[model samples]
Structures are given as structure tokens and as C-alpha cells.
Target: MERKYLYLDYLTCIGCETCETVCDFIHDGSPHIRIYVTENKQYLPINCKHCDDAPCVRVCPTHAIYRDEDGAVRIHEDKCIGCLACLQVCPYGVPFYSLKVRAITKCDMCADRREEGLEPACALMCPAEAIQYGPLVMVLELVNERRAKNIPEHRRELGEEELRKSVSSGYVLL
Candidate 1:
């Protein structure tokens, strides 16, 4: 199945929480998106990866968690017993027990809005154009293009030794 995912450009994000605000507004004032700013000012917006073999789905005793047609991992509120098995197993820590709903809640990629051909709230609201939604291949292409253009000039100035160290440490210097 061709599935869409959210891709973020850490270089472009300005740490603005417009994405968080819009998500909160969509989810009754409880934000599902989290933005983490690194010491180097890289803005990392964390959300559910919606893994194909989602641990959340596997751990749910009630079978409340399931993947939708678009490959979005979703929770059926009616079946959720709130045992938190899904929360415990999710690697991303995306699932949260909602006291109001008495169930587990997480990002569904705004499935309802997507049904109407709308982008996820975060992508639609990001002012920096840092967030994109599409098939994985397309998104990764964009990510690579942006990273190639935005390699910090300071890294390039650090000479071959630092450049090799950075690359070895999993920093995408290119």
C-alpha cells in the first residue's frame, strides 16, 4: 500500500509551535504533536511513525488498535480498555491515556480531514514549510534535497578531520 507520512526539515523549522497549536485545537486542546529543539537549534517535531509492524497494535489485548486503509495506526475508542499496553509498547511514545475519553489517544494523521482531501493540520499550518505529507519516497527526496542545500557552513569549515568524525557519528554532513 502507498502510505503517506510526515517529513520535517530540521534546518528550516524555527521552533514555532503553530503545528502544536493547530493539533491541540483539533484534539480538544490536547496536543498530540511535540517539538523538540536541539542545543544546535534543530527543531524536531515528533509524532507517531505509524509503523507497519506497530508494537502498539501487537500489544493491545482488546484489539482496539488497528491500521486503517491508508496505513495509519488508529485506536477504536469504544474497544479501548485503557490498560495502556499500547502506550507501553509504542517505541515512539506517541500513545497517551486520555483521562477525558478514558482511552488511549495518538495521531491518526488527521484521518477525518484526510478523508476530505486535506493535509494534516501540522503540515498545513507550518509557516516555515518544514513539514510535508506524502509517500515515503517523495518525502525522502525532499528531505535529501533540503539537507544537501542546507549543510551548515561551519561544518564544512572544520576541515577533513571534523567532517569525517561528523559523518562517522551519523551526522548527515552532505
Candidate 2:
């Protein structure tokens, strides 16, 4: 199973909250949102990292969270005890309680849609192209290309290096 990752460009985020709308659309049946967008002076969207060393998988009391063959961290809702252990262990705080199902849920990286070569709902609907999906290596290269060209000389206090590093880390985790 190939690993997949998501990339984000904070500078491009319009803070429109469209990602939140699309998340609800994708999970309309259960109305679950494993991914969501929020603003803190800047548009910020959060989602499950599906960590290479997933804390959720380790902490699930019932073995309810496991990575599929394709490398997606998925929840077996039927086995869930509603313990919320995964919710507690996740460092990124991405998972959310599903009131409709009485279970915990988080992003599966749009695994089903990705298998069909379609983009995740948020990535597709983001009007500013702030969100992206692809192989991690490819996305990193693209990000580097953009960074080299656009960062201005006077904005160094924003710390391009630190910002780039943080964003890259976020991509790998997502």
C-alpha cells in the first residue's frame, strides 16, 4: 500500500471555511467530520495525521483503530467502546466525537476517493488552492519551488525557514 499525504500553504488560505462545508458534504450520512477548517487570524484546517507511528492505533482498547493495507488509519466503529482513547492520544487533536454514531472518527485521507484518483473534497473545493494532495515527495518539491520565488526580503521576521519546516512537518503527518 502506498502512503499518501496532504500539503497546505497557509499563505494561500482565504479563511473562507469552504473546507468545513465540503467535509460535511462528504460525510453527510453520518455527518462526521474527520477534517475541518478554522481561522486564527489565518485560515487553518486540521485533519488526522494518520501517523506513521499512530498513537490512536496503539491506544484503542478494542483494537478498533488499525491501518488498512493501503496505509490508511481507519476506525472499526462496530468494535468501538466509545472509550475516546484515541481522541486523548492524538497529538494533533484532529479526531472528533460523532454524535450521530456515538463513536470517534477522523479523516481517512479520503482514501476511497483517492483510490479512484479523485482529490479530497476540501482540496477540490478550496477556492484559493491552499490545500493539496499527492505523494509527499512530489508535494514537497512543489512547495520548495514556490517558496524560492515568492517570499519577500522584508518579511524575514515571519521566518520563512521555520514556517516552511513547520508546514512540511504538518504535511508528512497528515
Local accuracy by lDDT, each model = 0.81, 0.70
Clash pairs (backbone) in predicted model 1: none
lDDT score of residue 55 within candidate 1 = 89
Ten contiguous residues with the weakest lDDT in model 2: 29-38
Candidate 1 C-alpha error for residue 104, in Å: 0.6
Q: Candidate 2: misplaced stretches above 4 Å?
A: 29-41, 151-174
Each candidate: RMSD: 3.7, 6.0
For model 1, how does the per-residue alpha-carbon lDDT over 4-109 read when each residue is reduced to its tens digit? 7776666667678888889989888887788767798765677887887888888889999998877788999999998988777877778888898999888888
Structure candidate 2, residue pairs in collision: none
lDDT value, candidate 1, whole model: 0.81
TM-score of 1: 0.79
Q: Score every model by TM-score.
A: 0.79, 0.73
Sliding window of 10 residues with minimal summed lDDT for model 1: 165-174
lDDT for each residue of candidate 2 in 1-174, tens digit (9 for 90 to 100):
466666667666666877777877787743233334345444466676668899999988899898876566888888988878888888888667777777787787686787797867777888977777767777688778666654453255346676577556543211
Q: Which ranges in model 1 have alpha carbons more than 4 Å from their true place?
A: 36-44, 150-174
